[model samples]
Target: MTTTIIPNLQNFYNQSQQKQDNHFCDCTLQWRRGQLLVKPSGQVKQPYLPSLHNQPLLVECLKHSPVNLVSIDPKLGESSLRFWADACEQAHKPIFLRIPPGNKLPKQSSQSLRWLQRLIDWMIALVLLLIISPVMLILVMLIQSDSPESLFSCEWHVGQRGKLFRAIKFCTTKKYKLTPLGSWMCKYGVDNLPQLFNVLRGEMGLLGSRCWTLEDAVQLSLKEQRQLNNLPGITASWEVETQPKLLHLDSSTL
Candidate 1:
């Protein structure tokens, strides 16, 4: 089967092949039509599953195959972005997608306007914190009363221009564990209230693309990484548009 390999990843394939390390780049890429492309580094141990016979081969391949990760070709269309994103989340694998050349970039606001917006974000976050202090205190008390553990969670996220920052949230999940109160906090995003401090500290904004975790961000193509040129935000279009579909997919998988 003919698999078009992107030139940039050719070296990675070569290195993986030389090292014979399945741990490094062992994956099957779904190329044009129903063909499967194994990373040249090493052969994928799983038998080939043809997509022409069974659609959703990407997800199925990952679900059943022994391969540790998978990559999707960008030509699969915009909908594939949503599809693969959900698929990768389910597989808990690193995702890689090539953004087509000359893709229109998000317009960067002028420096002065950016400063003004930052000023506004700081002000709003401060006011929100003040207004919600009592509610936040109550949530904290409820959380402590329910779980009796650390009150916050700090995760590293990639911010504007690839700066790493610790994003703070209520410790709603404790490494495969969650309490009833923690689940409620997560469901309503009350767990995220601590991020107001991130905004106040100029590490985040009121609205923009949700900052991708460092693990995910580094895997993105340079063009896709352009989305990070702007500050990370509390919420973004992905929530309203992309996330509900993912939730549905997640539910269907269960």
Candidate 2:
């Protein structure tokens, strides 16, 4: 009996082999045939009364097997079975598939409120910064006591239309030789208050793509740079949302 396995299936098997013994059974087996063929010596038992869905067959097979996770790739062109498999896979259930059609592009919303909402958020942030400047001064003085260096760190950030400006914040790292208080403010994002000045000055907006450093901005692909065409740069998104995750994934891939 000859069976053909997808290259991804082989990779999954190799990855599974490196797992701990107690976790060794989490294998996703993918087959490209109409029906699954089990080895008589294989200890994993098939689930009784399995669904006919082919998309998630691998997942279902894994459930029935001693393993906690499994995936199957079956013969393509069977739409009904493929739909069931896709649904099962989405639910994190076991299923099989033969690589269905590519996903459709998502539609953009037509509501005109997005711009107005961004403007309102910017105004609120600006007002809050003005009301808090006095307190910020006091904090700056306190930071200066901890480190007798610069109380604020000025970082060059890229904003909308590829404009560059200095973004002021409290320093967080002792290695930077800035005021210790600046470092404290940076650690908690308290130093980001001054960026409200940038917002009011039209160099930034409240809810938009994050501003990048010149070095980082150059790394953006042409397609990614297009996202900047309509919006001002932001202070927080890259640090808070995107960079850490991307770095982790890149390291893992390497």
- Residues 1-254, model 2: lDDT tens digits: 43432332222223322332331122232333343422111333222222333436645543554433223322222333334334444545443222223224324553347556667777887788879979988876776677656566676555544434566665544443333344345445576676777777766777677666544554556556554444454545435724453344344444
Candidate lDDT values, in order: 0.59, 0.48
TM-score of each: 0.53, 0.44
Highest TM-score: which candidate? 1
Candidate 2: C-alpha RMSD after superposition: 18.9
RMSD (Cα, Å) of candidate 1? Answer: 12.4
Instruction: Provide the global lDDT of candidate 1 against the true structure.
Output: 0.59
Residues 30-91, model 1: lDDT tens digits? 44443233332244332232331233665665666554544444343334334555555555
| CA RMSD, predictions in order | 12.4, 18.9
Query: Quick one: best lDDT, which candidate?
Result: 1
List candidate 2 stretches off by more than 4 Å: 1-122, 173-183, 233-235, 238-254
The TM-score of predicted model 2 comes to: 0.44
